[model samples]
Target: MTKSIEAMWKEGFVNEACLTAPKINDLYNRKSQNIVDKFKDMFDINIKAVIAGSLIMLIMMSFIGAPFLGIYIFCLLIPLIIIAKMELKKSVNLSKGQSSYDYLMNFNCWLESSIETYSGYYKVFYPLFFLGMAVQGIVSQAGGKLISLLVEVLPTDIIILGQPYYLVVAVVIVTLIFARSAEAIYRWDLNIVYGRQFKKLAELIADMEELRK
Candidate 1:
């Protein structure tokens, strides 16, 4: 009788384990579907906003006698469009349940291509980034010169305080504020992108674990 009881318990445990696998799989599938749906909504909103903002800027520039600025904006925007297209393609591929290995291989290839393209533009981008600081310096110096010229033209009563000193102080404050804000934005974007990538990697690892089980 004891032997028969032991055999029954073993069979029950096997049945329970077998039932749990499908439950776990269903849960994972539902979670993955939710994530994909969220991404789709976000991507749609982002693309719409980008297109609308770009069109508005283009139209405004034409009316404001700044058509050249619009053209420059288009030139800068093309690379971003290409990047978005690549990312969208990858996202679609992932959503289709393509094999993870294949998806990763394609993603790596896309990244390599992007890096090559960016390498060609690295010279220009680096200079542009530093140009902000250069511009700040030029603006501060110009402010000082303007203040000096104004002081010369004004009557002594109007020049009660040292104008150049005040102008320099104002320029320094503006420049520092601009620099700090730009740096903060850059860091925030970097962190957000990195975090998303990390989350995707974690999900892939979990999927692999499920497969192993």
Candidate 2:
């Protein structure tokens, strides 16, 4: 039964490829195939959101003495991650063969379903995410100040090796590196997926061009 399902999927893919082959070729030859812009915009939005939220959290942590702020940020992030995965799946499905019109419809349907499914959770999630960042900033600042005070009391020798100021600096540097790395990974994954889809589209176009000749 699994084999049959696989075969059916392959057959559908082939049929869709054949049907869209000419259109795909035309789109490619137009010298304005800037579909990457669309994908880039989507990625940019997510990056901006994450960065902005993280900065807010950092500020809050600096001022407050609450670890719960970090927890709240994590909680809000969970739903965003879920939404992102859903969007990725929809994009993959659309790239596979669905027409833009159909893809839009399907995407909207999925979005609606997701909203309904997570409505109750989001009501709590968004506010917490925002509040958490505020709290995190406060806590982080407080933590930094506390460490500075501790360092001040330590022997000058110990201060040279592992001062609280140094620790705080290290943490900031590490956080920035991690954020950049995460963005890079996301971009790489997106490029790999888009490259494969484009290659397949190109092959279909070549076949259609040959047939036309």
Candidate 3:
């Protein structure tokens, strides 16, 4: 009778584990999906906003594109566009069901990486664009006006081998400042969009781990 009772107890524990595993998995899936869905939606909104803003920028550039080097810089941006596409695909995969903590962990890393890469790209993109505008002006038949203007504005004493050292220094300094500011702004915008959702995911991971304990 004791042996039969032990056998029954063993079967009951196995059944309990079988039932509990799916329940825990379902909980993880449902909670993770809720957070992931929200994050994806937020990213989509940012993308739309960015696209609209970029169109406006391109429209403004078109005013000078034909007359300047803007078109070349714009053309060079194909790689950045490709990177964005790859990141979008990565996000699409991220939206799939994941019942383990590893999913959230992967997501956390991806979020940081995405924000850094996207922001850093724009830092390079913006300066190249502004510099391209200068090159564009110089290459255009009407471009002498810009060089003359720079010479007229910069101090005469700051000349280096007939070129204005002060102007070069000023442009470099300004571009660096602009690049840093663009990076900061991009980082802030991303944080604004996805920060809350990321925090929620972290919380979910913490809670789920605690329950496991």
Clashes within 3 Å, all models in order: 0, 18, 1
Model 3, 1-213: lDDT tens digits are 344644443343334344425655566667877787788787666566555555555666778546234345546465566667677678777645443566776777787787777887888877777666655555565666666787777647666544478756766777777677888766676668667776788788786665544
The local lDDT score (0 to 100) that residue 144 gets in candidate 2 is 61
lDDT, model 1: 0.52
| lDDT at residue 110 of model 3 (Cα atoms) | 83
Residue-by-residue lDDT tens digits, candidate 2, 1-213: 344644443343345454434454344433222443344356557656665675677567546655466555655666666666665555455342544333434444553454454454554554444444433443566756776676677524434224444554555565555444554544465457555644544454454344333
**Each model's TM-score?**
0.47, 0.35, 0.63
Q: Is candidate 1 or candidate 3 better by TM-score?
A: 3
Give the Å error, residue 81, model 2.
Answer: 2.5
In candidate 2, position 139 carries an lDDT of: 50
When summed lDDT is taken over every stretch of 10 residues in candidate 2, the lowest stretch is 28-37
**lDDT value for model 2:** 0.50
| TM-score for candidate 3 | 0.63
* Tens-place lDDT digits, model 1, residues 109-190: 5544544554444334334444443443344657467656766875344322344454445555765555556545544654
Instruction: Quote the RMSD, in angstroms, for model 1.
Output: 9.6
